[model samples]
Target chain A: MRVLLAAAVVVTLITADLHFNKLSTARSLLDAAATPLYWLADLPARLGDWSEAQVQTRASLLEENERLHRESLVLQGRSLQMASLQAENVRLRALLNSSALVRDDVLVAELVGVSPDPARHQLLLNKGASDEVFVGQPLIDADGLLGQVVQVSASTSRALLITDATHSVPVQVNRNGVRAIAEGTGALGTLEIHHVAATTDIAVGDLLVTSGLGGRFPVGYPVAVVSEVERDPGQPFARIAARPSAALDRSRHVLLVFIADAQPKE
Target chain B: MDDSGYGYPVVLLTFLFAAVLAILPLPQWLMWGRPEWVALVLIYWVIALPQRVGIATALLLGIGLDVLEGAVLGQNAFSLTVVALLALVLYQRVRVYGLAQQAAIVFVLVGINQLICQWVQNLQGVGARSALFLLPAVSSALLWPVVLHLLRGLRRYYQVS
Candidate 1:
């Protein structure tokens, strides 16, 4: 009888999680209790990182500093052009009477942990609710779009990668502005664009960027590049696949993009 | 030896360390073989001290694991509660078994945990892979003797109730 009661309680809990948001606060609190365990688990890797930094030779550090300086100078030069382009874009938007796009601020976060289950592609970030991170906050790397925040605790958050099978991003072809949705295939190396008309303008090698149609991600961030396109004469839709632009497998640091109006609904 | 207050805290610390091991990041290739450390440790406690570590304790720790893994809530809790109940029922027979025999039982328990998790995940629309998901149960059973011996040594050394 007691075993049956416990099973009932478990079923109740699962149903609550599926159908309502009532358990989120409780989950956050439980996650906070488990934070120290994750930190302890990460100790060996953190020690290795610390030792690697400490053992770096001064000459190597000087060489890295010089390289970084040159890279920063080039980036600054590009930023000068970007400033003028932004002003022009504002003017164009005003001429067309469309709302000017708001700039997104970013917060740098460290990868503290990862989801244990192999079926899910998620990374836990060091920054969480205390850092003002909320669910649906977009994450990016130096290269391109990465993913979005799915759950937040007090000092950590879980971000689901674009490679997760359940995740999809709205994207458009940079070549001809043909919009489609890129859906993750659960495998790290690919995402598929489904339901495209056989005659759609999409082709191999076209760059896919965020369309911002769903108001979830900022517009024009590179998402993927079309790797394969198959159009069958008898089929109504083309089968398309693309490679995600971000180094989803290798990036250690990620940026949380804070857009004013893209806050996910509670 | 006595029912002192130190007993509960020691158990908690052991479980805490197990939780840490369970979530530690591994290289991609080794992830499937990572043992379910929390489940193994919980099994140890339920078998060793069934009166103290019961269904409620398993449920609580399982929920903590669910929160830690970011899995659907109650998945681990359900599996663990069942495991604890089974351990409770079979504690007398399990106590008399040789190490190898006990490990076979551990295999079944961990396999049940994995099976329940896989079922819940499928219900939530996650795609199923092949039987590779059951790898943890095999790994956990292989490590059961080592975990049992180490934890037993600790219990004796510390004189935990």
Candidate 2:
């Protein structure tokens, strides 16, 4: 009798969660309560980082600082050119009667935990609703798109990586502007582009970038580089695969992008 | 056998510790073989103190796990309730069984838990492509004796019953 009651409750909860999403508030409350568990799980990694910082040699630190100084000098020089280029682009857009592009704001978030189940490519981040992180916000690393925020609590959020089996992104070929959808193949390194014509101009090594057609991700962010294109005379569509540009397996910190228009109105 | 005094906190702490171990980051290669720590702990409590830890306790812990993993709210709850029911039914016989026999029963229980979770995941279109999802069951079975001993030690130290 108790088992029957529990089963009924489980069925109702699942149906409600899947259909109406009415339990999001309850989920967030549970997430807020569970934040300390995530922190506890992350303690070992944090301790390792702390010990490494404490044990670093002075000479090695000096050498790393010198390298960063030189790299910053080079970056400063490039930024000066970028400023002038941005001004020129805005002027051109004004002349063409097109709206000027707004730079996206990004919040840096540290990874707190990852999905325990290997089959799910989800990340738990340290930023959440308190940081104005909303569901569907795009996440990126230094290299490319990483994932999107799926659930947010008071101080923590969960993101599903682009390499998750259920995730797909709209992308265009950088070389030819041909559009296609890149679907995750449940592997960290491979994404599949389905339904391309056998005669399409896509080639191996072509860069793929977000086209912003879906309006979830910003335009022109590097997504992947085409790795293979198999065209067979027997099949009407070609089989293509690309490797994700983001360091999906290695990045410790990621950025949550906040587009001005996408932000909820106060 | 209604020794409710001081038993609740010890059981709750064990479950909390199990939750931490469940999400602790592991190397990619090792993740597939990671044991189901929470399920093992739940099984231990249900068997050792069936009156205190039954289907209701299982349902609540399962919900907490679902929240922690960001899974559908009732996915773990349903699976764990089933595990608790099986453990409850078999507790009498399991109490007198040898360690090897107990471990074999645990394998079947955790395997069923994994199957139900995978079925729910498949409905959501994110299920694993191969039988690798069952790897945790094997690993959990292998770790059963260790978990059993450690939890038993803790239970004795705290005089849980």
lDDT of each: 0.88, 0.92
Q: Kindly list the interface RMSD, in angstroms, of each predicted candidate in the order they appear.
A: 1.3, 0.9
Candidate 1: count of backbone clashes, pairs at least 3 residues apart or interchain: 0
DockQ of each: 0.68, 0.85
Give per-residue CA lDDT, model 2, range A1-266, as digits (tens): 88889989999999898878899889988988998999999999999999999999999999999999999999898898898899999999999999888899999999999998887899999998889999999999999999898888889999999989989999999998999999997877999999999999999999999998888898889999999999999999999999999999899999999986886422
**Runs with alpha carbons beyond 4 Å of true place in candidate 1:** A262-264, B1-6
**Model 2: residues >4 Å from true position, as ranges?**
B1-5
DockQ for candidate 1, C-alpha atoms: 0.68
